[model samples]
Target: MNENPHPTRQLEEAPVHDQFDVTLEDADLLGEVELTTNLIIAASESDEHLEAEEIDRILGVVPSPREDG
Candidate 1:
């Protein structure tokens, strides 16, 4: 076994923000997908009444999707 102060593997810090993808798609279903996952958050009209996109189209209101129970 190697016991050295220097790590055999390198670690990266302060990653470049541009390298991350932050685009939301239209067909993304609100429930299954997490808003904070994959550095992207999708927003669209809420199916409050199950009408689908009839009203209240999501537009970064909360940076996450809210499903009605």
Candidate 2:
């Protein structure tokens, strides 16, 4: 029932990386599945979904971008 008789016939490894990694995250993860490679925003539940507008409203100040803009 094995498609490939030999394991050494892997044409590629790790697969191709998509140019972008855009994702829509929800605060309430009630019935959601936890991916092993998900970009977890915060360690605590109280401080989640770090959107720019949300961040500014919370901290009462504009937050610096983590990555170079």
Candidate 3:
């Protein structure tokens, strides 16, 4: 029960830019999902809730806090 009239139709006539645009969009979405999943795992394994400073450290945005700071 496919809704699209051209469900099996080929994209042979489609423009190259259109084809590659979709590919790039898909890759970007996949990367975003992967990063989010990894962050969630890191947070869950951490002893305490992830703070802004800790998150920055994980992302290498800032240096790790000093023990005496």
Candidate 4:
């Protein structure tokens, strides 16, 4: 009389963590992740691959080996 075909199968709740173990040092990494995600989204909107200027602009915003010098 069960509506579900797989009535024997039971679903379990996923584990939840109220707190994260992030540190101040992780802020820079998180920022980079945000930037990269935005770049990916913007690139997906365009039909063609990233242009030289666009690549340069991204590189300019992000830290690179050249910046270390």
Candidate 5:
């Protein structure tokens, strides 16, 4: 004698770990990821193309020597 067409299912709660370790390298990588994501967003919004120097600056990359002179 069930009137409801669907029945609710119960979900088990997952245990939470209060203690977590963060390394300096992990933080640096996270910062780099954030910066890259922001750059991608800005690039997608802009109509103009990004210059090589600008790209290098945003990625913190050193510009290599161009042989095509």
Candidate 6:
């Protein structure tokens, strides 16, 4: 018993992007932030060793807090 009567309806139309406006650069930045956050969380939870490049990438995405303000 399928709850959605038109299961394939979503596939027939184009994707709707009315929720928010995000440029390509913004989208890429968001993706990097998301990946870095996930990696940081995973590293904190497990004892796995992160490669030098991975560590650099994660550090690059995280913003440093202001000291003066």
lDDT of 1 by residue, 1-69 (tens): 778897687677876788567664655664325533321333233233422342224333333577889
CA RMSD per model (angstroms) = 14.4, 15.9, 12.0, 10.9, 10.0, 13.1
- Model 6, 30-59: lDDT tens per residue? 887787788878689767788766676666
- Give every collision pair in model 3: none
Q: Per-residue lDDT tens digits of candidate 4, residues 19-62?
A: 78555468788888877887888798889998867866865655
Query: What TM-score would you give candidate 5 relative to the actual structure?
Result: 0.42
Instruction: Provide backbone clash counts, one per model.
Output: 1, 0, 0, 0, 0, 0
Considering lDDT, where higher is better, how would the candidates rank from best to worst? 5, 4, 3, 6, 2, 1
Residues forming the 10-long window of minimal summed lDDT in candidate 3: 15-24
Shift in Å, residue 43, candidate 1? 24
Q: Quickly count the clashes in candidate 5.
A: 0
lDDT of 5 by residue, 42-67 (tens): 69987999887777777778867789
Decide which is better by lDDT, 4 or 5. 5
Off by over 4 Å in 1: 1-17, 35-69
Sequence-dependent TM-score of model 3: 0.42
Candidate 5: segments with Cα more than 4 A from true spot: 1-25, 62-69
- In TM-score terms, candidate 4 sits at 0.45
lDDT of 5 at 39: 86
Q: TM-score, each model?
A: 0.16, 0.21, 0.42, 0.45, 0.42, 0.34
Model 6: CA > 4 A from native: 1-25, 50-69
Question: Evaluated with lDDT, which candidate comes out highest?
Answer: 5
lDDT of 2 by residue, 1-49 (tens): 7676666865667777786964647644522334212224332444555
Error of 2 at 31 (Å): 37
TM-score of 6: 0.34
- Model 1 TM-score, all chains together: 0.16
Error of 3 at 15 (Å): 30
The stretch of ten residues in a row with the least summed lDDT in candidate 5 is 16-25
Error of 5 at 28 (Å): 2.9
Taking the tens digit of each residue's C-alpha lDDT, what string does model 3 give over 1-69? 659875786657755465545444587788777677778889989998899877766655767678985
